[model samples]
Target: MTKSVLVIGGSGGIGSALAQHYAATASVVTVISRQKAPTQNSWHWFEDTLQSPAHSAQCVQLALEQRPEVIFICNGVLHDAAAMPEKTIRQLDTAILMQRLHANVAVPAQYLQLLFSYITKTAGVKVVVLSAKVGSITDNALGGWYSYRMSKAALNMLVKNISIEVRRLNPSAVVVSVHPGTTNTAMSEPFQTNLPPGQLQSAANTAERLAQVVAAVQPEQSGKLLNWDAKALPF
Candidate 1:
């Protein structure tokens, strides 16, 4: 059967790479992003206005109409033009925190909720969200990036809760979070100096690795956080 794949945030570095990777094999690849890129399959241009719940629901409805077998939510924000990751508690701003929550937490969860109605109720659906290792509550050793960390942690919790509900609703459906690692993307450019020599990865390389990880996940493994190598991470 021809695979149907949907990639949200397809304009970003990792997201673009993922769309290209899947377009090479997937029967139909639908990409949603702020920019309308020339795609191998289809494109859905998203607007910032979709951040509103009602607007997002419409966007989700449009995507669900595609009936994608695999959905990858590449939406997330570590930093932006106005704000960077907080290095101390004093740097925590309500506006910045709200932005992070909307991007990393609310948006991803909205997509997941809209997807539930369209995914197979049996077992064939797979949903992957681009999460971060810093999101792992038990894995936190170094403390910083308050807004980013808090938002992602919330996202992780949503993934866990969604996984349980999905398993009950559809025995074969799987939902999990993934840590793509430190890739050479615009989002990581500011932090690249901190990474070791061979630690930084190209967007294409990370996308390929993550594709493999997604393919290897099992239904029973739902709700777990996985690294790029497919290793399970602690919640």
Candidate 2:
């Protein structure tokens, strides 16, 4: 059982479920999000925009004090009320692209940057960044969702790079990007219409599967991108 855990973006659907999952056994659960956490869980919540590095650093410093054994970076955005995914290059807007990048890549990047020192020195730490399978360059058979795809692809690379660096300092550490499948959340509601039957998972189910995957991942698979079933996916 995990003794200590840190969850970023803990107010989101899947993220909140993950916090609840870990809270069952973890003695200390730390969460950072823009909204207040649900009052039911006894997690240590730090509400922040996570836009400024100095602010993010302070939140991370407090989390590290708990000596978390597991960390989840779940910050991401697909479509918002103002913008839907671009279907073609002509439909792409620079503003939408920047918004996707800022949420999917930059925000998580900030937290990872803040946790670098702690990750390098800590042994047996498992870092799981929520990435999408659509991010895979090799898996792009049908092209669409430009902004979301590009942002996730970039996020995958960041996880790969961090895994390599952290391995050299702490070989026991496990850092990998994981695709949490298409959960029944607001983020996926827009795209769920065409998904195959049973493809959409409930937030609780996704959380359970992700917990199992994180628990089973080994140090040797540190730099890989894994599916919800724990299968390694191509980056």
Candidate 3:
């Protein structure tokens, strides 16, 4: 039988590719885009303003009406605002951290909170959020990009908590965070050269790997972190 899938940021690089990939097999492929998504299936638009508590409360009310079986949150922004040698702790702006949190952490946090009822009610629900490897607590051998790293770390915590809560409420919905690897997107284009040879995963490669990650999840595996290749990660 055909299944249902919802992609929160289905307009961008990996998200769009994922949307297209699932639409081929899923009977219900829903896309919530910042821009207009393809009209072939169910599509909706959402603005970043939904990150605010007041707006997100309302947006969540509306989204619950969709009754999704799976929810994939693919929203994130990585602005390595200060490059190396450009600034130091003495010159760092405190406000930059807040902006970074809002973009990568706060927004997705709000979205996940708002999406509760649908996720908890749906059977075999899978909620996957796009996170980064740099956020790994044990894997931080090399360190920089304080804002970006902290934002994603916060996001990782949110997903981990959500997995527990969803398991209690839904029992069928498996919530897990995933690291998509160093991808060749606008967000990582500036830093790709620093990546080891053949290490920077293309958006399509990321999406394909992520699709496999999605397929690999089971309810018993909730609250875990995984890489795109289906390998478990250290939380």
TM-score list, all predictions: 0.91, 0.96, 0.85
Candidate 1 or 2, higher TM-score?
2
Q: Ranking by lDDT, best first?
A: 2, 1, 3
Evaluated at residue 145, the lDDT of candidate 1 is 94
Strongest candidate by lDDT: 2
Q: Mind sharing the TM-score for model 2? A: 0.96
96-173, model 1: which lDDT tens digit per residue?
A: 899999999988887788777665463578889999999888999999999998998999899999898887778798
Model 1 steric clash pairs = 123-172
Q: List lDDT for all candidates, in order.
A: 0.83, 0.91, 0.74
lDDT of 2 by residue, 1-235 (tens): 8899899999999999898888876558899998876667578998887567788788889878888999999999999888998889899999999999999998888888889999999889999999999999999998989999999999999999999999999999999999999999999887889899999999999999999998899999998999999999998
In terms of lDDT, model 2 sits at 0.91
Clashing residue pairs in candidate 3, if any? none
Per-residue lDDT, model 3, residue 4, is 65
Instruction: Show the lowest summed lDDT stretch of 10 residues, model 2.
Output: 34-43
Between candidates 1 and 3, the one scoring higher on lDDT is 1
